[model samples]
Target: RTYAGLPVLGGDLIVHESASGASRSVDKATDADIEVTDTSAAIAPSGAERSALSAAQAAGDRKTGAEDAPRKVIWAATGKPVLAYETVVTGVRKDGTPSKLHVITDADSGRKLYEFQAVQNGTGTGQHNGKVTVGSVRSGSQWLLKDSARGGHRTYNLKHSWDETKKGSAFYDADNVWGNGKPTIAQTAAVDAHYGAAMTWDYYKKVLGRNGIKGNGKAAYSRVHFGDAYENAFWDDDCFCMTYGDGAGNKKPLTSLDVAGHEMSHGLTSATANLEYSGESGGLNEATSDIFGTAVEFYAKNAKDPGDYLIGEKIDINGDGTPLRYMDKPSKDGLSYDYWKSGVGNDDPHFTSGIANHFFYLLSEGS
Candidate 1:
């Protein structure tokens, strides 16, 4: 069954076969049969093609009325074969009867993860026997769970340290609140540290293939709300850590995803180009962070905050309201320049920074 433009992660064929039948999967489903209506319309990089979903069969004893286990298949995608994430469909059936949904990992390889069942929850024309999601997972890291309708929403947090040797962790005060003076769902410290750690780990592992912030494989520290009314977030080479300030007007926390990616990318820059923070090189330095920061956002693909060209729109750096910078047309912000020019001393990092910033945009987004 299809929901929205994204293809349901799994399909209904699981029902016709016996509950304990061998896993039979199909990778190619004709567009006509599925009736896929893509809504996101997100374009892929040049020459990139998407992988198709296959209907799989389960394995088990088929004779003597023995129940046959459900088949498993992996939603695999790789860098060479780039594809947008597939939308997985979930819900229940019409008669309030629960349908079994299984997630089998490593289906290609005989080494499969334990099969877990998912419950179906829906009724009438909208009724679906199983759930489907269009996403891929890392190999050797597969899981199976019962259909959701059988129980509650299953929430997961991927918390792997890209650099295991890195030490030091930041903590948040779950009960503390900032400017508004009201209690927060979580303390500022925890939020800042959580993102900082995740960014540092993901950047090194995914981009540079390095172990951690210090290619030597060491952990860094993060602190939030250093003092009253802090207005910026920064990383200090001396401290080898980062700090954030609560926004001045509203009680916005400074440890936003972009900010964290920005500050952390600085460490990456220092390690490589070591661009002097005073001239065009300096502008390149800042753009480096923006580029990687934006990349990280795209990699995450969080439903509420997917990737885009804009930077720091969440922080609200503009006193009135606007992103801190614009890659497509840097000058759109008025405070920053659009093109490069000679003698533009990096005196105003924000102003002299336009050229490289715009260049990175073109490189990533294309003209």
Candidate 2:
């Protein structure tokens, strides 16, 4: 029988149902116009096999031929759900910084398609460079960094807030000298709960079809300015929220879309497929956030900040007029690795973080 609107290919196998209420597989290579076989199970596909077959069929570009592939005799035999959808985040930040993040998720279940966070912004901080935390939009958390000179240790808090005017929100420096300009810490988180919360809420609802961090359809919490010149942003599952640091030397804020999305995606990762951190898995975990964060920017569709593949495009950490991270090729950063190889140590979690970072680059950008 002639099939219209179908992509037919040689070597393709298809099944046909007869008037007798029976099904059979017919190999296109040799079958007659109307040939019959027996039993769907005799030609049924198993989950593991089905995925391979689907991939092969897709690669073969046999869109029409595969249409007739027999349905698994049993649903289990058919294949894993093809719920994954590719999501790409592409745009440039307001200051002309390039940014982009990619994600893959189960289209039906609304599960993550894929995630990755590469190094976006970095500044020298003791043994660690400036860091970006990717986790849930949790709430009710605080941090206290040592201030021996102050006699009394400095205390910081984390809270999530919402605002309609800024077009975005953040976990800001509430009490830091740099935060709201109290002038105690020397630097303050430029963006506050408004930006962080805006990113967290926007990314999930817009890209992943998720309700919130919990996927229960609720708002998240955030806090800004957690310490004296605190130089980082983080999301802690235990705390269930995020915290930010005041900029360094009056440079930039830690609440950009990539940073906020990175932190928020961490929470989503923890909630589902909690990929282990510290090694290859850890890198994958980090990349997941970066990917989602970039996507969030696109989903926002903010004309002011069109999305792109670069992370931390605005908050210039290097001061050399370049992005903190490049998803198309992460090695663009002077420090970040392009691909995985030997000597890639387990020493620093972020250094080792390159493995998944590379994986995501390949997954989203394609090798």
What candidate 1 gets wrong by more than 4 Å, as runs, is: 1-189
Per-residue error for 236 in candidate 1, Å, reads: 0.4
Model 1, poorest ten-residue lDDT window? Answer: 123-132
lDDT of 2 by residue, 279-327 (tens): 6677777778877877776665544456777777756666665766777
Error of 2 at 50 (Å): 48
Predicted candidate 1 versus true structure: per-residue lDDT over 1-367, tens digit per residue:
4344233343333323446885555443222243322333243211011111111123221111102332222222211111133212222234323233343333222232333323322110100101112111112233221112211211111122232233323221122221121214223333333433454455566566876666665655555554455567777777676666556642555655667777878877887778888777777788888888777767655443457777777666665667788888988977777776767764577666777778878887788
lDDT score, residue 321, model 2? Answer: 55
